[model samples]
Target: MKKVALLVIVTFSVITTYGSIKSYNNLNISSGTMIAILIMIISLSIFLTLIIDRKTLKKRYIEKENELKHLNTELEETNIELESSYKKIEKLNSSILKILELSSFFSAPKLMERDFEKKVLDLALEIIEPAENGAIYLFDENNNAKMVFAKGYDYEKINELNLKKNDLIIPEKAEIIKDIHKINKNKMSPKKFAAFIKLGGNLKETLITPISFNNELFGIITLDIENNSPLKNYEDYHTKIMDYFGKTFAGFLKMLNFIKQEGKFHKDIALTLVKTLEYYDNYTRGHSERVANWASLIAEKMNLDKRKIEQIYWAGILHDIGKIFVPQSILNKAGKLSPEEFEKIKLHPTKGEELLKKVDGMEEISKIIRHHHERYDGKGYPDGLRGKNIPIESRILAVVDSFDAMISERPYKRSLTKDEAIYQLKRMTMKQFDGEVVRTFIDIIDNFNIK
Candidate 1:
């Protein structure tokens, strides 16, 4: 504005002087008109300059606004990326927690009440979303995949289509099918493909995962999703999770087998010890085996669980193991044991317990053996554990043991008739034996042949 104003003043001064000179010379134009024209030109020039400056300021402001908007867009995109990453992290954490829960569940012994394979499948279906149904195909003795457990599918139809190793298109770890109908014809055997399609007519997607450990395949797990499934996309994580579960189940089975073999090995050792005891005591040659059988039968009649019955059977076998420590002279004596000899005889239960407790997993059996002589009224043992204080297995052992002793011919006593033995058991019930156990035993043996 300053430069423009200065230039306008100089131009107007020159024009006014020229107009004055011309007017003086020829009297054609007046100096006053020239001055008025110069003023209008100056005013117009100032207005245009202001408009131009305003336009420049507006353009710069718009540029700055656009830069801010671009920055905000980038920040929003970054925030979205961060949010996605956080969600992924949360998902991973959830998966890890679920895996830990599975590890804990599979770690414990559920050998009695639960069908482990089916239970595992049920739990898997719960965590692995989009899976409407599943089946576990374990390899049978012939190395053929057999459907051991199934859910939400016709098990009989699937089982009829036995999946041989060569009939499968499953990857070593896992594979997913986007659409079951679109699966390549050559990927699986035609017979298997047709059977699968027939059995799973509504199935849209399938995830085939192998149960394996140390690269050795044990079985295959197949999970299905229907056409109307909630989640249509089978994510990478889903396959990973199923693969993890398959491997974990395989590991659990391996551990369970190891435990069973270990248990059998221990039982073998215990039976060997029983044989030694039987050899040392001729009067009780077949006593241990008979007691064990009768105890198991009584336990079964009482509806005890398989585990408890097995423990009772083993306890029966090992109950008299400590008699090996007793002097043969005292055992073969023709009369009743003297007080000192009786006291020594009473130590057998404790001695047997002490010996067996040293072995792993035999603590409960040792306890049963220790308290087998305990009376129902609390007056029949080294520990004198009374009634309910005694272990139920020990109480059962007492009934079977006393009845056998009454009927067996010993050095100083004649064998009682079956009727006499039943009377003795009845007379001793509630005093020396559990009334329920005694009743169960009598009922079982009434028609049972011991031979």
Candidate 2:
């Protein structure tokens, strides 16, 4: 409207300039007023255009600011979600690590023997934090419970614990709480409370978790509520962790028992073979055991690999297993043996290899036994493999075997003193044994003071 008005004013002024200039000059009107009116109309039109432009720019600026704010809000929400997801993933990773660490106890075939119950209790307490003390009770085939271990809590800890069948609270299913005051004194007695009483504390409520297998409860782990217990502010997340323990331990214990049974079977068989030697010659009683111990010391002194050490140890224990095949008369012979008798005795190493080779998983063990009697100079027996050609395990066994034989009293000769035995070992380093192995054995005997 202002532009149109300015146009109209300009048009009027132009017409007046031409039509009224001469008449105004006649009527006394000045040309300056016409120019001044044109300037006012143009200034008003320019000011109105500036006002419209400012409003449009301000509206666009506000719209852009609102859009930026919206984008920022969305980014903030996304950041919050990402942080939450990261925390969840972090927790999941931590849980997985804990499970794997616990599973390692099961993975090791040997570690689960002496400290099995203690390890289980420790892992359980870690998962179920602030626990005071606990006992792990394993049931026998007769469904009888025995407390195998107890640990944690200064006040409630037991240095030595033994739970009879009547003292345990084994359940037919998984459970979480046990009331000691309500338990039958004659059946599920709190016999373990006596140990804590000595520490000026008594038992209260117990959190019990039964380890079940094949629908039968085989074991129970119990955490206590004692004076020093810190389990007051327990959270809801502990349920899943404790449940995992019960189930995992149950499965692991079953497998662990199988390993133990297998190990015990091997020992029982080895002992049976040793007894045969003992029966034939009383001097051979515990000879294999001593040889094994000495071989282990030598292996450690040399810093042998763990697997190699285990192999050497077993080889030394069963080195003379073939003596059973030799005649009793030959083993017990006191005087110088006839050529036939010596030949029969030499067959022991071969007989041992044959006997053990038939068994499963004894391949390396049999090989070590076959070579234990071999000499470093390639003159020993069976294979006559020389120098480093002999297995490292066999070289280790030969040194300890000779050392043990020298120190041991035989029917044919007087036992050499430990010093005399050492001198003989040093004298025959290259001929009878590996020089490095013999040196390591000397260090073992000197450092460990085997006497």
The best candidate by lDDT is 1
lDDT of 1 by residue, 341-365 (tens): 9988898999999999999889989
Error of 1 at 126 (Å): 1.1
What is the C-alpha lDDT profile of model 2 across 1-451, one tens digit per residue? Answer: 6556756766676666567656667666667876776677667656766776688779999999999999999999999999977865665567657877887757644454577677778877666554567777777876556667777444224434444445556555444553453453445335655453454245555667778777756778777666444445333354455566777888877776776787678767877877777887666787788889888877877888666677777888889988889888778877879998888888988899999888765778999998888998999988899999999888988888888788887777888888999899989889978999988888768764444
In candidate 2, stretches whose alpha carbon ends up further than 4 angstroms from where it belongs are 1-71, 101-249, 279-286, 289-314, 327-345, 357-364, 385-393, 403-422, 435-451
Measured with C-alpha atoms, the lDDT of residue 9 in candidate 1 is 72
Angstrom error at residue 91, model 1: 4.5
> Which residue window of length 10 is worst by lDDT in model 2?
154-163
Best by TM-score: 1
